[model samples]
Target: MRPLTEEETRIFFEKLVKYIGENIKILIDRPDGPYCFRLNKERVFYVSEEIMKKAGNVARENLVSLGTCMGKFTKSKKFRLHVTALDYLAPYAQGKMWLKPSAEQQFLYGHNVMKSGLGRISESVDRYQGVILYSMNDLPLGFGTAAKSTSDCRHSDPGTIVCFHQSDIGEYIRSEDTLT
Candidate 1:
């Protein structure tokens, strides 16, 4: 992968910080390796439609791709955050454990956003869609935090414990007898 331009780096950092603050999770199923993020949603909803839009712009302007495949390949592409509570806490305070995203990954991310918009216009059926928050349960870890994931192995990754389906109400629901 090529080096990220200054702006790409800046946007990447912003995204990382925002997700971390919002407890938003990011999942990437890449050829190299699958990754997941458990973010902190303590202060506020850092990511907004506007931010997503900007991210879209950044991808187009910089020629970055968010994911390997764009919405063109699929219909009604969904964008959602899957939440899960950990029996053991994340390694934030532990330090070093937190990983920085590479330039290619960030580029691919920007592409995902752009594809969402194109998806709306590209298909007559509006097949390319947006993110879908699934299976959210319980409050954020800290007073102002949320959580997200990046799953690849599938087995090792935790399934949805919480979700952001209702952005306005911040609704969280339990799955069967899982959380109790």
Candidate 2:
């Protein structure tokens, strides 16, 4: 377990604040102790469970990994906010793409969504920007990138609306269900 270097800390904060917000700065002040850093790939850092605990009640048991992995990002490797972190994030993040239960089933299976499948969407999501995917009842399902801008998703009849579902709670449940 290695501590984050001063430079790494700065990079982490800059990247995280971009995805999340300035609010996350408070939690990473020291970037040591319970919080540990490991880089699985250059420019891709993984933060430990103890670090996540400081963010409030992150639901780690439902997650496959305790580490919150974030990348500097490219089209294929977009920024990811783990399901464990969603507990502390849903209230603060701006865009949530809410989906119906039926749509959620396919989505959990890694299917991209069409505009018709969205129950509701946030006000100003831009194309290619990441979004929080929410259940119809407002629970955070996971994270995704907007396949189309909010306007296009709202008005277009046949465009795909959310491309990569970065993570989802139902997918975890389904994976567990399969093991039995």
Candidate 3:
């Protein structure tokens, strides 16, 4: 693994900022210790400074992965976040949407959330904004982009799509062998 170059950092942060906003500072400057992003085989990993030091000693070929796999950089140079990033993104998400119990199963099955399934939404969310999807009980289920703004949602039909599905925790089981 190696440190992300300036260009890579900019691209990665641009995508991350959409979901977490300015909280990116909190991620890098945590009270406990400093953490950073590293790249290995196009996949980005979030690792603590101390762990990064240790990892540096291992041979590159043998170090398959280290720390939390945030996501991967596609061949086209775009970043695609993985479900593993939910833990980090949930706490700092700027826009959030809660799913009704009845709709939870639908979302987990990789379907886009419909207006009828939405239990609640952050009033600040705008159309096409990145949003973290949660269960009624506040469990972070996944992340997606809003298909409609808060006001549009209130007036739209129940069948209208509210959030577009991206990545979800279910992916861990559905694609177990490919993760990491």
lDDT (CA) for every model shown?
A: 0.23, 0.60, 0.93
Residue-by-residue lDDT tens digits, candidate 3, 1-180: 889999999999999998999999998898998898999889999999899899999988788778899999999999999999999999999999999999998998899999999999999799998999999999999999999999999999999999999988899999887687
lDDT tens string, model 1, 68-133? 211110123222222222211132211111111221222222211121111111111112112221
* Candidate 2, 1-180: lDDT as tens digits: 234566766755654553356656444554565445543333333565565455335343333333554433344544444455555556667667898777887777777877767888888877766677888988777777778888777568755555466666765566554211
Superposed Cα deviation of residue 36, candidate 2 (Å): 6.8
Q: Is candidate 2 or candidate 3 better by lDDT?
A: 3
Candidate with the larger lDDT of 1 and 3: 3
Q: Superposing all C-alpha atoms, what RMSD in Å does each candidate have to the true structure?
A: 20.6, 7.1, 0.9
- Better structure of 1 and 3 per TM-score: 3
Candidate achieving the largest lDDT: 3
Q: Which rank order by TM-score, best down to worst? A: 3, 2, 1
